[model samples]
Target: MPTSRRYGDACPIARALDVVGERWALLVVRELLLGPLRFADLRRALPGASSNMLTDRLRELETNGVLVRRRPAAPAAATGYELTDTGRRLEPVLDALGAFGSTLPATGAHLSATSVLLYLRGSGRPRAAGTYRLELDDRVFTVRSHDGRVVVVPGEPGTADASLRTDPVTFNALLADPDALPGLVAGGSAAATGAVDRLLAG
Candidate 1:
C-alpha cells in the first residue's frame, strides 16, 4: 500500500503507484511507449478523455520524470511526447497487465484506438531485416523495423507477406488466443481477405 510522506512502511509497489496510479496516467504512458506522438495524436488515440484531464495527466507524468515533451527538429513545427528511459522500463509491467486483462470477460467488447495501438505493439512478430505492408479490408498497415525500433503505420501501400482482416472484436479475441482465428473466420465473425491465418500462426 502507498504510505504518506511521513516515515512509514513504504512498499515499492505502493511508492510506484503513487506516481502513476492516478486515473489516465498509465494509459497516457502506454500511448507513448511505442514511439513519440503529437499531443493531438495522443488525444485522438485516447478517446473519451477530456482535453483538460489529458493535459493534467501529461503534466503529472512529466513532473514524475516518466515522460518528456519536445519540439521536432527542422521541417516540423509540431511538439510531441516521448517516454523517458525510466518510463521505457515499464514496458514489461504493461505487457504483463495486458496478458492478465485478456483473461477477464470483456464487458464493453469494444476496442479503443489506443487498445489497437497497444495490440500492434505487443503482438508484432519480430522479422528479419525487412519491411512488409499489411492490408485488411479497407484498412492498411505498414510495418518496418528501422534503427532497431518497430514502426507501424495504419495506412500505407506496398506488397505484404500476410494480412489479417477482422473487426475489432474478432481481432481482440484472436489476440487473446491465436487458435481462435479459424473459428472467427469460418463462423463469419471475421473475414480474412488475405493471408490472415499465416500471420496469426505464430
Candidate 2:
C-alpha cells in the first residue's frame, strides 16, 4: 500500500477501489466472509501473500472500517479478525466476480477456499440432495444443494449425508475436473467420504 491513500477520482467505484483495491485486500475480506480467522489462519489460507503484506492490509482495512478485532470471551484468548457490516457488503461483489471468472477460459491458477465455496453456491448442485460438512484446511462449512441451487454456511452440519476433508487447492482441482478425483484420491492428494460423489459434484 505504498500509494494506497486515495484514487482522487471522485467516482463511486474508484473510491470503493481506493479502500480495497490493494493486492490481497479484497482477499482478506473474502476469508472473513464466512466468519472470523486468526492471523495465522489467514496466512495459512493465503500462502502466496507475505506476512508483512498481510499485516499492512489488515492495518489498512481496520483503519478504513472493513475489519475489526473480535472480542474474546476470555481475556487470555487470542483476538481474531472479522468483517464489519460494510465489509460483509462485498459478498455479492465477490460472488459476481466468481461467476464472471468462471465463464472465461481456464487459467490453471490456484483457487482460494472462499472462491471455491462461492462457486458451489452459484452453480454446484449436489449429485444427491442432502446436507454435508466440508472441512477445508483450517475451516469448516456446511453445504446443502437441492433443486439445482446450493447453499453454504460456516460451521459443521447438524447431520449430514456425507462428510469431506481436503485443502482448498485440491478441492478446487477435484471440482474443476471430476475425472481427476480417482487419481487425486489414489495419490492421497484429496479425500472425501460418505456420499463423496454428492458433495463434490456439480
Candidate 3:
C-alpha cells in the first residue's frame, strides 16, 4: 500500500509537499513531464533512484492523483506512466524551479534528458524560428521556438526545419555549447541538420 507522509498542517504548500515531499518524487515527475515512459526507460533516465524507491514514488504519486499507470497498447504491450492533469499543472512550478535552480553554482552532475530539455525550454532564446525535431535517448520530441519562447511537444512534428539526434549527455553538451556541434557531428556522437541553434542557443 502507498503511504502518505502528511504534514498535518493546512497550508497549501505543506499540502503539496505532503504528496510529493518524499525524495525522488519530483524527479520522477520531471521524467514524466515530457511524455509517458515505461518502467525500464524511467529507470534508465533516473539511474540514481533505486527500483524500490522509484516504484514506491510512482505508487504514491498515482494514489495522490499526480500520475497514473497506463495500460499496454496493442503493439507495445508494455505498461507506462503518465502525468494526470493535476500532475501537468506542476509544469510551471517546475519550470520556475528549473530557472531558479540554474542560477546556483554548477553541480557538475551528469545531465539527464529531461534536464537538458528543460534547460533548453527555459533558457533558450533562439534566433531561429521553426520546428526542430529532437530525438533523445528517451524518445522523440518536437521543439518550436519563436521570439524568445520555446515549446516542446512529444512525438514527431508535422514538419521540422531541422533534426538533431543524440543521447542525453551529448545533447546537453552540444546544446550548451553550440560551437561543439560541428565536432560532435563529425565524431558521430551527435547529429544535427537544420537551424538547431534556435532550439539550442540559450
Candidate 4:
C-alpha cells in the first residue's frame, strides 16, 4: 500500500483501520502473536498468500511501526519478523475477532500449529491460580493461570498441577464438548479434564 493509502479521516478507528485495513495485514499480525517467525514459517502458516504480497504486507506493517525485521544471530539463521509494542496491543483485538468468528460455520480450513496455540490462548480464562500443561502432538505449552488470567508459554513446566495431551482434533472436540473430555483424554486424567474445563469454560 502507498503511504497515501488512508481513509483521510480523523476518527481513531478509521485511522487505525487505515493502517491495517489491507488484506493479509492483520492475518500477518495473528501469525506473529506468539513469537517472531521467519519468512518461510510465515509462508507455511499462510499458504494462500503469494511471496510478493507477503513482502508488500510486511513492508507496509514495518513502515507503520507495527512490526520490525531482525537479522540472523547465527550464520545459518534465518531473518525473522516480530511485532512491536504497538503491534502487541492488537492481542485483545485478535482475541475478540477469534471469539466472534468462532460463531460462524466451519470452513474446513487447515489450522496451523500457531493457529491452534493462539486459539487456546485466546479462549483461556482461568478463575483461580494453577499451572496446566497442554500437549498438542509434539508441541508442549505451559499455561499459568493466576489473578483471573492465564499466560501460555511454550514447553513443559517443571511441575504442573494438571496436564492435557491430545492431537488438534481431540483438543477441538474437548473444547466443543467439555462433557466429552473423559472419553477424549488419552490417559483419562481427571485433573487434566478439569484443567481444560476451567481454562476453556464459556
Candidate 5:
C-alpha cells in the first residue's frame, strides 16, 4: 500500500489534495483522460518519468480507489488502467484547471500552430465528407479526416476552406475570452485574414 499523508483537519479539499498532491500525479490523470489506458501509453505521454515512478504512482492511485486495472478480453492480451467512478468525477476539476491555466501568464506558449493542430485533432467537430483548408498569415494548412483520423498539413494558401491569421499571444487571449478578439484585432494587436471569422465562429 502507498503511504498516506495525515492532515489534522478533515476538509474534503485537503483530503483530496493529499492523495493527488505528489509530482506528476495529476498529469497521469490527464493522460488517462486523453484515452491512454495501458502503462506504456501513460509512460509515453509523460516522457521524463521513470518506469519505477510510474509504477509507484499507479499503485498509489489504485490503492486510493481512484483507478482500477482490468485485463482485456480475447485477442488483446493487455491489461489497462481505467478510472473508477470516483475518478471520473474529477473531469470537471481537470476542465476547470485547464480553463484556469489558459488565463495564466505562460499559457501563451501553448498557442503554437502545432498546438492548435493538436487541439483540432483532439476536439474538432467532423465536417461533411470533404477536404477543408486552414490558413494563417503566409502559412497554409490542410485539414482532412481519413479513416476517422484528422490530419493537418501546412501547405499553400488556396488549399484550405478557411484561414486564421493571429499571433500566438492574441490567439491565447481570444481563447481565454472570445469576446475580446475583436478589440485586440481592432487595436492592431492582432490581425486576421481569409476565413478566420469562420474558424472563430465555432
Candidate 6:
C-alpha cells in the first residue's frame, strides 16, 4: 500500500479497515482460520494473488500481530503461517460476513477448494455426531461434527461414518437450500444418510 493511503478517520471500523481493508488481506486471514498453511498451499487457495501481493499481505498481517510465521518442527521443515489470538477472533466476523454474502445472487463463478472449505466452516452446524467425508470432485476433506459445532479437517480420515460427494457448485447450492440435497449424488452407508440429514436440517 502507498504510504499516503489512509481513511483518515477515528472510527473503530475505519481503524480496523486500515489494517485489513487492503485487497486479499482478509481473505488471507480467512484461509488461515482452519490451521497453519504453507505458502504453496496459500498460493493454491488464492490463485488470483500474485506472489508479491501475497508476500506483502503476509508481512503486513504479521507486523500487525494478526498472524505469525513459523517453521514446522522436525521431519517437516516447511514454513507456514497461522493466525494469532487476535486474528482467530475474526472467525465469527468472517462467518457473519459469509452468511450475509450467501443471500446475494450467485455470480456464476467457480469456487476453489479453499473457498468451499471456508464456506463449510462458516455455515456448518453440528447436528450429528460422526465424521463426514466431503468429496469435491477430486479434493477431499473430512467434517467432524460434535458438541453443537463442526470441525473441518483437510483430507479424508481413516474412515468416515458418512460422506457427501459433489462439485463445489452443487455443494454451495445445498448450503443455500438444504431441501435440494436430494439432487446430490451420494454414496455411503445408510447411517451416512441419517447423519447428513441431521446436518441438512440445520
lDDT of each: 0.67, 0.82, 0.84, 0.77, 0.62, 0.75
lDDT of each residue in 1-202, candidate 5, tens digit only: 3444657568998888877877667777765653336787676556677888888888888888888898788676778888888777876787677666647776223333434454555454443333455543344566666555666655643555544556544654564466776787698766655444444434
User: How does each model score on TM-score?
Assistant: 0.66, 0.86, 0.90, 0.74, 0.53, 0.74
Sort order, TM-score high to low: 3, 2, 6, 4, 1, 5
lDDT of 6 by residue, 86-191 (tens): 9998888888888898899977466766677777665655456777787764667888778777778777677877677676666766667777666444432111
By lDDT, the candidates rank as 3, 2, 4, 6, 1, 5
Q: Over the full model, what C-alpha lDDT does candidate 2 score relative to the true structure?
A: 0.82
Winner on lDDT (4 vs 6):
4
By lDDT, the best candidate is 3
Clashing pairs in 5: 133-160, 133-161, 135-163
Query: Model 5, residue 164: what's the lDDT?
Result: 51
Q: How many steric overlaps are in each model, in order?
A: 0, 0, 0, 0, 3, 0
lDDT of 3 by residue, 133-179 (tens): 99998488998877777888789997899899999888877765888
lDDT (Cα, 0-100) at 166 in candidate 5: 64
Residue pairs in collision within model 2: none
Scored by TM-score, the top model is: 3
Candidate 2 vs candidate 6: the lDDT winner is 2
**Angstrom error at residue 80, model 1:** 0.8
RMSD of each: 6.2, 2.4, 2.1, 4.2, 10.0, 4.4
Q: Select the stronger candidate by lDDT from 2 and 3.
A: 3
- Ten contiguous residues minimizing lDDT sum, candidate 1: 1-10
Which digits, one per residue and each the tens of the lDDT, describe model 2 over residues 38-78? 89888877889899899999989998999999878998887
Between the candidate structures 1 and 6, which one is better when assessed by TM-score? 6
Instruction: Show model 1 residue runs off by greater than 4 Å.
Output: 1-9, 74-76, 120-131, 134-159, 163-170, 173-194
lDDT of 3 at 197: 67
